[model samples]
Target: MVTNIAKAILSVLLAAVVSGCALGISEIPVAELEKRYASNPPLYIDVDGLQVHYREEGKDNDHTLVMLHGILASLHNWEVWSRELAGRYRVISLDLPGHGLTGPANFEYNTENYIQFINSFASRLGLEKFTLVGNSLGGYFAWNYAIRYPQQVEKLVLIDTAGFPLKKIPFPVRAFTAPLLGEISMHFTPRIASSILLREVYAEPSRISEAMTERYYELQLRPGNRRASQTLFKRNLEILRQEPSGLEQLTMPTLLMWGEQDHWIPADPHLKRWQQALPHAKVVIYPDAGHMPMEEIPVRSARNLHQFLSGAEITDTSE
Candidate 1:
């Protein structure tokens, strides 16, 4: 009877494995996902072998603003802020390489690749010189862009930027950057991971809704998006190891905004570093906000941004 019981347990385990394999989560159709997530169908253009996706709104005068989204975040994150700024300056936003409808492109896919992509995209769009704004990973690229091509960026805005090393990496980034586990995760990621990420980014858990989390999950499953995400996470880890140089060297009129309650990377240490590096930078902190202050307090952030832009003269950085 004991031997029969052991045999039954083994049989059940084998059946479970088979069942899991059969019922594995599969890629959702891009058409279906775009229906809900792609609120506005972005205009596409080919840039350096990738069919780039971007939106250009607001006035077409010389005043221009180029915005970049964070890791795993698309141009949609700037929806609220875009509405506020688009009326005056020409606001252009994009999906950088590995994220959004832009899809994944074959490249080294490092921070450098992003820098080059930005250059190419701007060149193709005939962007002479524009204020550059970025958040999180987007902010990481923004500073690097400013440092490398100072001639192209008129002003810099960093929202919870990620150029410096971190005390602890976020779990989604950690999990996706792991070796074999990262590979397996592309196929079997749990839906709950999206909820956890959303909650961590926002100060108030109430801000995250089921529909928001659902959209994030659906976007991650956008064909090659998961694999691109893994590559981006791994590459960023490698970049963050080295302390970035030339923070003080970025002399462009700078704006640094931080959410005081940000859990990912605390405000004090990073903000202090920014203050030391860019002494003349205009700083703003939001008390109740988390990592995503732009989303949490769009109107306030927009008002601050407008005030800064209005006061400062738009320099011809293209020279």
Candidate 2:
């Protein structure tokens, strides 16, 4: 009887250990992220009765680079590039409604809503014309914005964007996109969930550092971000589904960059579509990189961007 009791205790302990490990896998402590990057206090702009938060770096009235980040991400994603590009071009990175320091939009979170957000952001900043650079969902917004306000856009750069709907989405996104299931899942997500998200953002998982994961986690926990993200996730399909055929309509010099190993939105079909639609647009596929090419291949990505912005001749067009 004593031996049986000991075995039972050991079984209970083993179960607890397994559960703890699962919970700990992605948890990133919020305090650590805040310790690393001091929150650049937000400048609020009243847009459609909601306060929108944004950070403006570099000189105003210069040629501008307006950066839009991906889904579930914040303007902080562009920290590396903003510093590099600020000297040459005024850089404006803002938290999109329903993400980062910015809370949910008073209106819907669709393409039209985002375009309005972009317009409001630019007009408030007094920008006449600017280069637009976006990643993932931002990539979608960049293209959409360029199409709607062609004259306002001087140049376009799409980094691992997600405008065209793929037949299959990444498992995590699919989980989050599901109706009631997504809502239920959000409640149970632990701190380590951020690391899992970071892992998905990169083609090379090893590139995701502890510090980066922590930053992403803290940003997610900021005031209204979690609930807003959940709502955005549920509505993403509707928003992304309405992708306009603006590739042919855009005349601005365009650069399309992608990670060849991207599992989130695979390269072949999307690349092929873009190439066929925008025959004049330049395309570059980074072999070792995954979904987030800017993060995965920042140096090369930055170089390509600089060259493209400088009007250097691009050689790669073959599909």
In each prediction, how many residue pairs overlap at the backbone (N, C-alpha, C within less than 3 A)? Answer: 0, 3
Q: Model 1 TM-score?
A: 0.88
Candidate 2, residues 63-140, lDDT tens digits: the string is 899999888787778777777777778888888888766656788767788898899888887888999999888998
State in Å the error of residue 304, model 2. Answer: 1.1
The 0-to-1 C-alpha lDDT of every candidate, in the order given, reads: 0.80, 0.73
Q: Clashing residue pairs, candidate 1?
A: none
Candidate 2's C-alpha runs over 4 A off are 1-42, 239-243, 314-319
How does each model score on TM-score? 0.88, 0.83
Score candidate 2 by lDDT.
0.73
Cα lDDT tens digits for candidate 1, 8-84: 54354446556665424788776776676664754888998888778878856569999998878888788778899
Strongest candidate by lDDT: 1
